[model samples]
Target: MRIDARRRAGLRAGGVAAAAVLALTLAAPATAGDATDHGRGGQDRTYSFTVMGTSDLHGNALNWDYFKDAEYDDSAHNDVGLAKISTLVDQVRADRGARNTLLVDAGDTIQGTSLAYYYAKVAPITEGGEHPMAAAMNAIGYDAAALGNHEFNYGIPLLRTFEKQLDFPLLGANATSVRTGRPAFAPYVIETLHPRGGKPVRVGILGLTNPGVAIWDKANVEGQMQFGGLVETAKRYVPEMRRKGADVVIVSAHSGADTSSSYGDTLPFPENAATLVAEQVPGIDAILVGHAHQEIAERVVTNTATGRPVVLSEPLRWGMRLSVFDVDLSFHRGRWSVEGVDAQVLNANTVPEDPQIVELLADEQATVVDYVNSVIGTSTEAMSAATARYEDTAALDFINHVQAQAVQAELTGADAALPVLSIAAPFNREAAIPAGEVSVRDVAGLYIYDNTLLGIKLTGAQVKAYLEKSAEYFKPVTAAGTYPASALTNAPTATAPNGTPDYNYDVMRGLDAPLTYDVDLGQPVGSRITGLAYDGVPVGDAQEFVIAINNYRQSGGGNFPGVTTAPVLVNRQVEIRQLLIDWVTAQQVIDPATFTATNPDWRLTWMGEPLTVTP
Candidate 1:
């Protein structure tokens, strides 16, 4: 059989390749698992191989940015999409020898772009349609992949369907069924490599997803699946992989290599624990880190258990980079032993997108472009989110308006009589809707994330506290004066030492009435909120109100106050982007005069006086 056939057979059988087939392996010692001489085993031999990794592909199959409705580019001029990464991978394979290399991914593959959303919602792949991601990945010939938290965004049924369409195993050792407490997905996969004349080497790959999934996607995974700590899960599975005759072990962890949790003790496990797994788990050789969206060429951690070095690498998200891990092994005493491991990341912008990938998904790409450009409504006046972060803009108010209406309509029982408010953030600084014809992309650009809307109850005092916490986004000003927007926004706090992200700074607005407040930058971090009121009246501490929030914030993301424990009032599993689109389709017109607050809903203040802020 051919080498590709043998590899597929090994993957399908989930074990070592047949000995007879190993003898017939392609005649090349330069490649992985190929010995210098085709002699029978009995002497020491060495082999080298490469593992190419990617994470957070996020439904990018091409170099086009769906939100921009144009080819993707930025001030950095960095390229995105799997097509570019494929070109880089092909170069690595040619340089390292095809059989000597393997391809894998950390996670976040099935969601992010319009291409992914179309197949998932518009013309679901579950209805006998092939998903573009599965097609692109299969054509690239991936050996294995891990699960990302976003994989559950569309719920389990869609995720399962996407999983079934893949040719490779999707490993998730820590994701377990709630009922039986057993693994809900494949725990790990053992891949065997045959040297020309040496003993076969078995490589174990373990996958651990983010435990935050239980909180972020509670509406989808509340009673179906549960996630465990990465370190604990690695400890349990690494020893088992060794017992199963794994010569080397690699972990594809969908967690960051840091020591912090957005949920803050909501679960016993830390949200970003890849470094902990490397330090505490003895058998790990290398790890491909994901979920942080940061670029890390290589990070080495010494395992406390064995004092051995384990290498970790995280290629930045959205296919901007590809991580390459090089491994060297030696055969001795009738077994293979890992000698060394190192890793580095390759920039996808260094090469043009592979023509094969472009050709394969050409039709799918066109469909998404056409869908996003299709007219959904018309705008009476243009609205820009340029200054939404520091000022109240019509764009954000429109979002809150739609979200508040959705929650208010869904309320039942006593919650129905309570006034409703909604929270929104400046997700994109460049998002804007041009006057006249509006398209799907126009609305989607305003809301870049795939967040679902949810309604939770909070007291008047809790609302003020939440706003106070959000006020932490602004640096303390000594006096009222004109200041650069950048200087005042994204203030650093204990939870966000690097500075708070704009998405974490939420702005609250009422549905029928304005929930107004002033952010006193002159005040300290915890006491910046003042003039808190509902409908021009001071809010009482005991007054209760329902607030519309996104699934991420409501589920402890950003470590916002009182939201996680707040009583959930509505959860329809509706994507906020979809709701915006549906609302636009129904309204057929987006007029800022109708939604924009007559007076500013919020303002920057210093000692009860308003201040001017500039971008």
Candidate 2:
């Protein structure tokens, strides 16, 4: 098959030709299986090929500025850029030549950083144009890629624009257009590589995006398309690929594995759709997985029907690592099959950056840097992003306070009088806001996900349950204590079975009510909240009270139990980050002193011994 012109641009730009003759020298000698079977019984020959894959690029086209630059002391964090990624890509290819290599991206390549922000806000690709990301990928030579949910972050029109710019086909068997009922993009692509004295071998590649895209990016994608189940979609596509003369079939899945189950005692094991896809799809061979930002190197079972070996490999997100899988291919009876496969994780820290790739990405990098650095707002005190320990943190408190005020004003109106309790997750603790200036970037440090504020009504019982759920992040130090620590670390060893740690025990701010309970780390969830009372009265199962939280939690974004089904009082279109920016801008001076966890009465003690409360 002829390579698309745009797909071949990278090679062309470097003045390389496929038929160019070079000195006949082998970097490494071929093994005994050096002769091609060629649809005839002959000595088996192994063809060594390297597959480079990346997932969750998240628009990190440059090195992450964890501090968002000095001017924006806003404990905001940035990440390694795509330019840096280009450097890594070149090094991998240089280490392994064309005859033995394939470069691929698992997904989530379009959205995340300032470049994405700029692409969405300033110069959208849809208005008769191309996205910077697409250009970058083209220059880098991506052989094949799958659809990440974030690719739809800008909707179908923009997605089409981005896809049109891609020299390589954007593959997705699961994602389909509602209007057409056919695959939204090409179901798969095949590449043929010719070796000395042998016919070309066809490698079939199919793609699967997370079915949850319907919910995750619902606002952007719902009206335009529908995502089918991963297993069903793969079953239909894989056989078609095989029938289309494919020798070796590889799946590029924009999904992730379940690492929490293996880690043990860890709460909130974010469900990765990749694991389910791998387990269900009756695939033919290897799988390239992403979307979870997980770092893994192992073969997983994709389907029992085919008993196929699915290789789920992912490097760290944001250009931190490059995953390389070397697969040996052999042809038998006119069909290609995977002989053996091995994987490796290439850390960006170890390799020298590639200069040509760096130069190609320079303009895009500078554009994004300038955009992020443009001052949007400022803070007088160091606004922190630390959520390591669940003591009331100044930054966390500030976020809650801002959200609370916004909710109160909207729900009760400016003249109404009522105390508003706002709930937030302490997931954004990557950067500690040292005492200094705070900027819009610093506000980003307070929260990462672009979640919006959500208002809901709950009863005293629901409030207690919510608090209990938060408190689940912590576990009592003893049968009579409340001190909480890393549940994973404190978990009991085999000899100390009764000392099991509670990984889901996290304390929630707000609500001062009485509770009585016997410490049972292993008790069922509903049973664990026994004798719960709010404001000196037993919480009525049906009594409703107003509650405020982010849209992510309300929409089951974090997989929090009961949250997905919660009643919505209001869906504030304003994003939490924007609210924070507005709040800071309105104040003109943000004092860390004013920020204190108002609900200090919510205390924890282990075995009746007070644990140091540090936010």
Candidate 3:
């Protein structure tokens, strides 16, 4: 994150030259309907090209849902996996002419689905096996890809293996080494396009990653790789790219276009700052955004520096959509000038799965399917996370129970005597474990994130503050009444103006006894927690306890209070999802009675009165 003084001086000097370059590269008026416009006369100086982009692939190789052990489909009829995306890509290539098109990704490539887990932990690609993502993307012929925060999930060695398997470069302009403060990956790549009768067009692709990687992946990147702000980083790199003779600059940003931060001021830079980069940085024509998992066809931001329009687009996650950016350039006096930029998203469900990607990943897909389907244990009763967010559920309690037990078993000295508590979130509402049998996928679905376990010490007062912070997930109610789950959940706040995600609403539970509290929706966010107690007694401010938490939360994720500076009681570096799987495999039976509290663990209230909720 340290800025080099010499580099700043060079960037300032380059900015003067970059302004001259922009003056020569004039923007010609063109409509979105126009694919290409030959010169004013018979000259072929006008060029039209396409950039196809995908983000947050997360190791979905085919249109198969390993959790359900069936083809992936939803009520929206959306299709997932790279196989479907490949078909869409081929269609775009055919229509736009393959030579005039380029394909790239916005990262989060290595960890999401059960297939990704199988490769990272079950059958690691580091041991000479080809990663399915690498094989699929290589075959698809990608030009370049940006580094995502999730790329550091399994650690650096595994990421390096996946990077080497790729046919193209993996770029990260702001990802620098802590020891050297130099770029760890290629900042950008220049691709030359040859027209029929005009000079070749040099297109610069700059990749910028999210700054939250410094907090979310602190375990993997701490003291090794540091991420810098996108706006500042782009200011330094764009001029250099222009100096390299790049006529048009396209940014593949692995950050959301919104100017928001989920981490709540934990870092100096915002988590989602793609729009900031486009507005503040000059010489950027367009940006391909990622990480928000939303579909944005086209958004134009006028640059503050040059008053020029910068287009941006984002595809839906898990290969459900593909973003296609159409760029038109005009050649004048032997120089290529940007004419216009347009973008749109294509639904992956509209096309059939690409047979090549499906066949290439057949072996790996089969291996993961078999592994996830293998029965690990039997559940005495059905459990679902459908209502875990608005009401207490046994499904989320199961995660906390397993997490707490693991930490308690490993505690030593003074930590062993301290009472143990566990925190969990309803990551997936559809996650369910049916009665009679449970498999690895059943447990995996409960904890969708790839977070490791950590035991951090906190006082009773700190625990209450933590619960109060989580209470922000619920909207305030003026009076007690029956409310719909959707109406009360995901309350909007300054930090989470779009509403808080389920993964950030943590529910804490005691290991030996229920950690009970009331979420008084009638009160404001910070004062919503009430009747806090542990072991059937009121919790005292001085009372200390060891709480089992995910590395994401303990490492400053969600911007929770006191946890970042809390003393570490234990650090097993074990994935919580794997711990759930191993616990099921060893116990051979998942009984809710063993973990579920006899009384209601927590309840929703409005002005000291219990409130009713409906699904």
Q: Specify the highest-lDDT model's number.
A: 1
Candidate 1 clashing pairs, residues 3+ apart or interchain: 32-100, 33-195, 35-196
Per-residue lDDT tens digits for candidate 2, residues 1-615, read: 112454354433442211111111112232222335534455355565677787888776555453355311122332355566666666665565555456778888777666676676557767655677777777776777788877876777777767767766677777777887876676777666555545456677777887656655567776777887666777787777777767667778876766222111221223255565666666456778786666786655656666667677778676677888877877565455677777877666555444655576667667766755555544555555544444445666677777767766656443233334567666555755545455556666666665667666665666666765544444444344333245412334343355422222333333222233222343443334444444445657776555567765665543446655555544433567667765765786677556563344244444333345332
Ranking by TM-score: 1, 3, 2
Worst 10 residues of 1 by lDDT: 15-24
Considering TM-score, which of the candidate structures 1 and 2 is the better prediction for this target?
Answer: 1
Runs with alpha carbons beyond 4 Å of true place in candidate 2: 1-44, 70-81, 127-130, 259-276, 378-398, 401-421, 425-438, 448-459, 465-541, 544-615
**Model 3: how far residue 208 lies from native, Å:** 1.3
Off by over 4 Å in 3: 1-44, 377-394, 402-437, 445-508, 517-531, 540-579, 582-615
**Per-model tally of clashing residue pairs:** 3, 36, 0
lDDT of each: 0.85, 0.60, 0.85
Q: Give lDDT tens digits, candidate 3, residues 10-112.
A: 4334442112122111122222223244656644467888888999897788998886788988879889899999899988876776667778899899887
What TM-score do all the candidates reach, one by one? 0.80, 0.69, 0.75
What's the lDDT of the predicted structure labeled candidate 2? 0.60
